[model samples]
Target: MQISFEEFVTARGPALLRFAYLLCGDRYLAEDVLQEVLARAYRRWSRIGGAPEPYLRKAVLNQYLSWWRRKSSSEALVATVPDRVQAYRTADELAARDEIWTLLATLPRPQRAVLVLRYYLDLSDSEIAELLGYAVPTVRVYAFRALGRLRAALSGRAPTTEARSG
Candidate 1:
């Protein structure tokens, strides 16, 4: 059975916004991008009125990638600090996290997007590829390389036992 757009938005809005936040790492920009994607979805409602979940997610991902391409760098996206961060006993963890984020900013946009989607959002490779218009193996490769760089970036301060990715 089909649902109304209002109902669809009500169900998907928060999740979509969270995905945006994960990708852009900016709450404000995430909100803005979410609004923009929803507007586009609304405009193409008839064409994408069914199975809108993946459709909307793909739009959001494409919008983010497009915006990143136009921006010429991910520094503005990954270089900024999260609003609230944990205070560490040695301050080394915080410093390392900061440095990792900085190195993340230096990565190419697609790799950063892959890391954000795979680890940060905990999305499956096929789901990421579907959303980002990449091949499944490509997602795997990008995520693998991103994690390798991240491990190197925070080498000394690596989690003792393996904690969740932020």
Candidate 2:
């Protein structure tokens, strides 16, 4: 059965916001993107086919990429520190996570998107390729290169200029 736009948003909005935040690496920007996508989805609600979640998610990703393209040159990289530390986690774990996020922020948008889709979202390479309009091999390459840079950074070595350019 088809659900109304309000109902869908009520149920899925938080998750969508989280996904967008992960993608854009900025909570405010994530909320903006999600709001725009949801507004568009509401206008086309009746025309949207089955599995609206996937459609909405794809829309968020596309919107994020479009926004990045427009403001990339003006964007500043910042380390996103949690406002409150969880009592259960060790300091080292939090530090590592922060370091990884900082490194992730430095990656090119497409490479970062591939890594996020593959690892954070746990989507298969083919699924990510389709979502990003890339070939499977291209998706794999992005993941490989992204991971290589992360590994190099974590190991206290700098990635070569060639790797950075790609």
Q: Which has the greatest lDDT?
A: 2
What clash count goes with each model? 0, 0
**Against the true structure, candidate 1 has what lDDT?**
0.75
The per-prediction CA RMSD against the true structure, in angstroms, equals: 6.3, 2.3
| Alpha-carbon lDDT, every model | 0.75, 0.86
Instruction: Report the C-alpha lDDT of model 2 over 20-63, residue by residue, as the tens digit.
Output: 88888888888988998998998899999768999998999999
By TM-score, how accurate is candidate 1? 0.70
lDDT of residue 39 for candidate 1? 90
Give the C-alpha miss distance for residue 46 in model 2, angstroms.
0.8
Clashing pairs in 2: none
lDDT of 2 at 14: 93
Alpha-carbon error at 144 in model 1, in Å?
1.8
| Off by more than 4 A, model 1 | 71-103, 156-166
Best by TM-score: 2
Q: Estimate the overall C-alpha local distance difference test score of candidate 2.
A: 0.86
